[model samples]
Target: MHMVIYALVEASTKDEALAAGKTVFDRLVGTDAHSCAVFDYYVTFEEEDTSVAGKARWGDLPTAVPVDSDDGEELLDRGWEATKEEFERNLERVREALDEFSNEEIMRDEDLARHAFHQVGAYDGPMVFLYTEHASGIRHRGQLDRILEESENPWIVPADVHF
Candidate 1:
């Protein structure tokens, strides 16, 4: 399977963003990272051909929507009720499993909770970082945040990667 990862780079122009993104990727994920070359897939929010590249500006990135809210339903909807139903069912299963585990046990196994509930990752803060499949990007979030702090105008770029 392939996933789209949103990478936030601090730069005032597209070329700058691309360069910064490449540097960040190279430093953190290495030059020969698995799946895809970061440079080959990086695209601005203004790009029309890539999925999740609809926003004309970084400021337009949408906030995370609660899974049970109407907006979440709309976001998950693809003109099929079955899709939404399946998503809800999966979410319910996760919730049930959580109920069965103690808070300390759940805390000790953070990956379990992140994997179960963060399937559809979204940016919900002042700055966006590289967001990939729930676990991958999150694993490096702290590093990305520190790296981006040195940037001027940070923006998210969507890149397609194979899994």
Candidate 2:
């Protein structure tokens, strides 16, 4: 089974964020390691309100996406169309749920951890939250910390990573 790990990568632009994410991924999982890649990367601009709103909007979307198996078979039993329709119908509710949280609450590691499938690093605000696919646990966090520390840019980017 595939597992996900999250990190806060400091970078100015989305391209820089993605590049940092790739570096982190390669360091943690290694170039010749198991099947792994940067699953998602988000870059937040300087404005706090804008960043929070953007994050809230992103938080409103559904996590599951339609996918096909290696044999060209549909994996989702309900099929993509039905699932998408359901997602669209429930978007308002999702937004409402997100609306309940304050900006500070939304960026809290404790709150974020509550929704994650695995352990995650701390988030401050308006930085890249890099999601990657790899085998990792609590211990991997130390390695991540080291990697971030060694870099010239600030280490931690604060944002929620939804599974």
Candidate 2 lDDT by residue in tens digits, 89-158:
4444445446676656656733452343121222211111233222232133455446445644432222
Per-prediction TM-score, please? 0.36, 0.24
Score candidate 1 by TM-score against the native.
Answer: 0.36
- Identify the candidate with maximal lDDT: 1
RMSD of each: 11.5, 18.2
Please state the error at residue 79 of candidate 1 in Å. Answer: 20
lDDT per model vs. reference = 0.41, 0.34
Residue-wise C-alpha lDDT for candidate 1, range 32-124, written one tens digit per residue: 444333233333334455543334322233233322246433432321233234446547756865887778866666537645555423221
Please identify model 2 stretches exceeding 4 Å from their true place. 32-163
Candidate 2 CA-lDDT value: 0.34
Off by over 4 Å in 1: 25-92, 99-151
- Position 18, candidate 1: lDDT: 55
